[model samples]
Target chain A: MKLLELVALEKRYGERPVLRGVDLAVDEGERVVLVGPSGCGKTTLLRLVAGLDAPDGGEIRLAGEVVSRAGAVIVSPEARGIGMVFQDLALWPHMTARENVAFPLRARGVPRRERDRRVAELLELVGLPDAGDRRPAELSGGQRQRVALARALAAEPRLLLLDEPFTSLDPELADRLRGDLVALQERLGFTLLHVTHDREEARQLATRVVTLHRGHLGEEAR
Target chain B: MSRRLVLGSAVLLLAIAGGLPVVAMLAQAFFAGGRFDPAPLAGLLTDAGTWRLLGSSILLAAAVALAACAAGIPLGVLLARTDLPGRRLLAALFTVPLLLPPWVLAVAWAALAGREGLLAPVVGPGAALALDRFLYGPGGCVLVLGTAFLPVPLLLTMAALAEIDPRLEEAGRLHAGWGTVLVRISLPLALPGLLLAAVLVFLLALGEFTVPGFFRVDVFATRSLERFAAFYDVRGATAAALPLAAAALLVLPLESAFLGRRGAPLPGAGTRRRTVPLGRFRAPALAGVLFVAGVLVALPLSALAARAAAPGAFREALARAGDALPRTIAWSVTGASLLLLGGVLLGLVVGRRELPGWRAVDGLALFLFALPGAVTGIGLVALWNRPATAFLYGTPLVVLLGWFARYAALPLRVTTAHLRGIPPALEEAARLAGASWWLRTRRVTLPLLGRGLFLAWIVGYVFCARDTAIAMLVYPPGRDTLPVRIVTLMANGTPGMVAALCLLATGVVLLPVAVVLPVLAISGREDRR
Candidate 1:
């Protein structure tokens, strides 16, 4: 099944088109990586899919539901059950790992006991169970990325968006995390759309790769 | 290139102007009775009035600080975090009270809340009961001072809030609620900045003279001013000023200690982009913001406008002010120029080289910043009123010196900040190129510091123009500045004329700066955008 689909996406700032005539699709449980140079609409595409932004001209369908459509309807990120890890990790510097992991569940009005149970399981799954009580500031760069991942997965979203999530981490940790991410994705059966400027990171993590150049999506590869 | 030279010259001139009054005053204080008098020192410690004044001043300052913090913190949060409607308009309105002279605010408050004033018409017979009686006492002093100085904390809080990483709030939003986000993340991150702002506001409130004086509240500043103007007792006033100065000294260490702690890092690379929507609260919040702005900007201005429109008020005030306008402007401009010159020279001297006790010198320069204008005036009067120090007193020079001493901090701070931005390599390169010290400074350093110089001059000029406390005490007989003229006219029951003169004075002082500010703002916004 098509987990996510964007048809003829277009975005403009004033007179300048940022993202124009873009179409894409990702299958269930598939890890698709989008690669582009700066200002090439790679991040914009991820943002659109995550529902952080609205498309100027497009229909976005997730799990066979029309989430966003031109001149019709648009779903909020929270309402769409979409999880995103921004380029900055966007981890709450003030929250402990456990608390961060429990956030999305809390937002969904999960009870404290079940929230705690799920949070602990997610932390252990991310290989940071021991660091559950530590704040993001107290964690290493790689640990912070893990916390972000754990937080994103807390709500049990069907699809996940990662925007250069490992850019700030050391190369060795990035490699280790990429392996862990693939293993977790396989186990969880959650589709992923990851955006990165690093070709090596895209090549390593992607089951399918899509190249974006100057606001246009190029040939897709498997 | 010429602009740099003009800016450099202005800075150099203002510094000298700022320093002369303090120098003259200190000379007089030390040389009294042919030596520094111990009698005045004893009088200062033992006087009942002095202690009462000190206690009242401290209490008033504390009250004002708390009030300002309470008002400013929430407003700052609304501005920085929430997508409050008219946030831009509120931000601009918040700064209006800061620019208006304290005397103007006090008079407006008096007109509105005083007996037989505006509120009387609405409140009718039971008006006295409805209004707080203490509004003219220490309580009123605190209220006026707090309202006047609230913008400082508001500005500081906004700056601090802007620096906080928004992702912290998002993290909380994901886990808990907006309340959790505020208490756990926003408050803790903004605490240091808020506290620093509180301390500075407290210091300023403690030193304030005009509000207390107009409201019949007897704080240290008012008492010190009284001693000089009413009795010409310079020694007595100087002695009274000592305790307030000592209190200021105590606060200095505490302020530095708070500032030493690390603040939240500013939003930059790797920081999340998040703007919390105001949601349903948008309309009501915007209304609340607008109401506050209306009360702050409209109340005093309306009262002044009404007074200006009264029969013969505008014509009489303008006629009198017209005679004094040229002299006032000349004194303010000349004094500011001298102050700028001295500040730049001193800044270059202290900032460039690794001189022994440079830190101490910098500390001393900032020391007078804490002293109230009235206290400084009293000290100056004490020092210069002696026969031996007659050369510096009762002259136009005395008035100029008084303005310079009171406002020296402006140019000094500007020049010092500017000097720090210049690269040391440029100077080293100039030296290696065989340029003399004077040549390098004149050609390279002066050009680099042009903007700083212009800013310093403007700051000094505005401060000199608006200042009344020190200028009142030492304006020699017929050489009163605009503020002094307004104050004297108000005290003598010429309310209508005083209001007109104030509007004109404020306009004259603010117009040039106001005209340039938008251009500067546009350029700044363009750069950032």
Candidate 2:
């Protein structure tokens, strides 16, 4: 079943057209990796999908409900039931691992006891149970990556969007995190729409791979 | 043009506008006639009266800074971080006092708390007497100057908060509400800016003369002005100004050593900023903002309005000080234009660190900025009142030069900050495309800086127009700005007439911003599209 759909999406900054009349879809429990060069509208597409930005022209539907259309957002980002791990790994530097992981639950009105249990479970699942009290700044790069991943999954998002989340890590660390991510996805059974510049990364994690070139999506390769 | 030419031009401009005046003043102080003399300088420095005045100035400045920061920080958080209603309007309202001369606030407060003032009817005469007494001393000086300078920390806080990596907030948003995110993420990140604001407020309040002078509080700034304007004692004025200048000079290094690196760009500095929703608390937050605005801005302005409502008050103001308006406009325009030119050139050289001594140049300009307007005016007169420079000194050029000396830092800082926000790659790409330095700066750099330059020009114009201390000291006879005119007329002018003049001066200062900001906003929107 389709979890997310984009119909002829378009975006522009000034006179510079970024995303142009692009159509795409993602299915439940499937990993779709989008490969594109920098500034080719990969992040723009992710932001549009996450409802952080409205398209200049197009419609974004999640779970068959329109979330965004040309120049307007029907559903705000937090209500879109989508979790994004930004390229910068955007962990709140002031919050400890446990607090960061528990944030989504708290936002959704989860009680403190249940929130704590869920946060601890998420931390253990992310292999950082012992690092729960450590802030993002005190954690290692890879540990920080794990914390971000844990935070993203804390709310049990229906669709997870990763915008080159591991790009900053060394190849060795990135490779390990990608492996851990795939295992987590398999265990959690969540739909994934990931963007990357690494073809090897796409090969390792994608159930299906598509290339974005000059604002057009190429045929999917499984 | 070559880099050498650019550096040389900046040096010459700085020397003429800022450096030479200070050097000439110090030279005059240390040399009697043609020979070096230290006795007079030494005697003046050691005077008990001088120390007492300096102590009073320091205490006043410190109190004002603390009070401003205390009020301003929370106000900034509300305006910048929260989803407060009328945030933009509230911000603009709070900024009104900063654009006017600080003494306007003193005048407004006095009118509100005086014997026949607004509060007298409201609180009855007995309590009003106590408030009146409080309004005319050190406490009153702090209240007026603190309110006048509050926008420094408030605006700085907003700017700093705006510069935070929004992604951090967004990540927080995905999990928690805005209240948590602001407390945990946004305010912590913006702490450096808040601290910088406190330091700036302290310096500004210390250097302020008009507010303290109006309240009958004798700080060093007033002493410096009194010695020169009242007694024509150049030596005494120079002696009075030396400690203030030294104090400002010391702060330069401390600011450099402490807060210099705090402004380094955050990772992902240019990302889209997201606003926190006020949600259920919007009405209360808005009411709180309005209350603060009412107390700080509206109440005082309303006093001026009520007083000025008398028949023919504005006409009387125009009749008495009407000529000063045209002179104010011309000088402010000329001063702002010159400041813009000097600012852009200096901003580029210092911001890009193209010269080895850019830090020193930057520090020197900032020290001049922190130096009281009276000090800069004294310096300019000492430098230009010679037979050879009589043509320059006897005209309005001396006044314009004093303005450039004191307030050039506004445009310079604004331009430098704006330049920093533009990525180096834009210019480097032009360079790689075979563009010369001049061509790259014109085509690639300056276009990106258009909004910033416009903003700087407006700020420069307002400061030049509203200046009291420097204009009073250095303006050629019959060439005073509106602020100086108002100060001159205050002694014998009726209360209604004085209030009318203050309102007219405010209108003049606001007219450009009111006309330009909307146009800039529309242009900004068009650019975004």
Candidate 3:
């Protein structure tokens, strides 16, 4: 049931080695939180897994298929069926909340009626049913975060990556969202690979916690 | 009332100097013996020859704009988004053409491709003659003007692309390839700026007269000037210019409708900066950029330099220039200083968006900027040529007014953009300290906006120094700017003298830029440190 695998993945930016011979694997329906200091390559590992970047040296397998190898993306990002919510949410400012959530569905060639239904359903699930017509700029900070999460879930990917999703939120809101995320993941059964600097967020969100320090992984207590 | 008065005065000045003259020219074209008649207007518009000329002009502008975008966009992308080799030097070289006037480019091109050109000895007479023949038509105008204005799209594209949040593209990339992501996300975000650049290039090429005139291309811009000078007929000139004015008027609304007020919002925090990797294409891209820089910019300039290398060329040219050299310097400095002052006032008005009809004022300024110099010239003469207004009409003030009307948009845009980064609270705080408006402006606002105003002044000076049509049309007797003098003297002046004068004029424009850029760079470095 291994959904994603990164075997000795290596990445460097100029002379600086960010991810050196890093190896990790995530099974289906596992909530794996990655904690690291700034510049410790947690985001790099997420990007590599999501196929947004090619590794300098390594092989990445998805469902036992070689998706990337030796600085080449054998499988393109869209074909990888991976969803990522960036730290900033990165919602398209020009799009309404509904359109932002529906983008992935439209991209996947989902029918218009189904896409609308799914978008509405997702908006409702995120507690932003009334915000479908609003732009990212029109939404509150917490509302925008919900929209981003909804967007990431739109395509129904097997693996979902989160990079510091609640880093910008207040403690109360972050705790509330973390609880909601746990419920949603339990219901959906998608593998989660979340990166955050907050230890409490990791402890609360993860079934298993992994620490990435100086381009290597260290397992943490459950 | 004071704020209203301030904004109102600025708008009034624009209306009088820029708007009224154009209206006067249009009125003259459509009226005879104080009666409104469309007969003359219809006659001119219906003329086959007029249409032919306008058609040629449109074709030329379109071709130039198309060529500029075709080259400029790729260059912009490579320079801004890739780790291309020597990109910094290549960018600097490419922008050299923009510093000089279009006519100077035409002159440099002729020196490179004419029968008696630098290439004549190398390529032999027959091929040189063939090249010379090609240089005297629409093809030559497109090459010269396209090269001259290439920086418009180049710089704007870079600016546009720079403003896009990299995360937007990254988000798209998580579900798509770079190509699809670019098309769906990056390009859509950058399209407004790209469109604006293309429109600007088209307007500029359409308004261009000197290069077309030099090449004997007979575009509407030149034809309008020809009509005015040849027959002293304001009506005829206005008829020729109306097409360009109409085109400008049409484009103004379209630009606003498409671009809105948004200028590619600032990139967000934690957005990882990712460049488009040019893995295998790096060398080819660098070669392409360098090839363009060499052919379009370096070659012609080198030819001009060689031709002006005669021992006494500059000395003789300076001697012949007499008071023109000094006069050009004086006029440009005065014009730039005056423009900076006016631009600050107008910038505050437009940027704050507090005054009524500010958008209209802004649109009018842009319209004047886009209006052909010949049209503005014709309009100015019609409005100001009277015994009662002799003081204003007969002196250099008339030319200054024309400069103000023509180049107002430059300073205004600079100040407006600069004003966005400035907080209004500083001025409000000063005012709350019981300081008068003048005191707050002098102490708080002006001091803060100094660098932007300095940049505006330099831009104003560059345009003023190289200005031809406005000065050619409205300059008082014996008060022609150096550009006007060089343009007029190009026909009969010695090769060395003309080349030297071109170099001298270019030098005058670059002098301030050379001084300011390094100072700014040092200041920037200091600030960074």
DockQ of each: 0.21, 0.33, 0.44
- What's the true lDDT of residue B451 in model 3? 76
Q: Rate the local accuracy (lDDT) of all candidates.
A: 0.73, 0.84, 0.85
Name the candidate that leads on TM-score: 3
CA lDDT of B342 in candidate 2?
82
Model 1 over residues A1-222: C-alpha lDDT tens digits? Answer: 888888998876557788888888889889999999977887767766765556778789988888877644366556777777877876765567887788788777799999888998999999998998898778999999998998888898888889888887888989999999999999998989998989998898899999999999998888
Order of the predicted models by DockQ, top scorer first: 3, 2, 1
Segments in model 2 whose C-alpha atoms lie over 4 Å from true places: A1-84, A91-161, A168-193, A206-222, B1-3, B24-53, B250-271, B420-426
Off by over 4 Å in 1: A59-74, A77-82, A90-140, A143-158, A183-190, B1-55, B78-87, B128-134, B165-187, B226-239, B246-280, B319-324, B334-371, B375-460, B473-477, B518-529
CAPRI grade of model 1: incorrect
**Can you write out model 1's per-residue Cα lDDT over B340-410, one digit (the tens) per residue?**
87667657755764344544445555556666677667666655676986776878787776666666766
Best by lDDT: 3
Native contacts retained by model 3, as a fraction? Answer: 0.56
Candidate 2, residues A73-105: lDDT per residue as tens digits?
888777877788988888766578888888788
Model no. 3, DockQ: 0.44
Please, what are the lDDT tens digits per residue for candidate 2 over residues B296-326? 8899889988888889999999998778988
Native-contact fraction for each model? 0.24, 0.41, 0.56
Candidates in order, TM-scores: namely 0.78, 0.80, 0.83
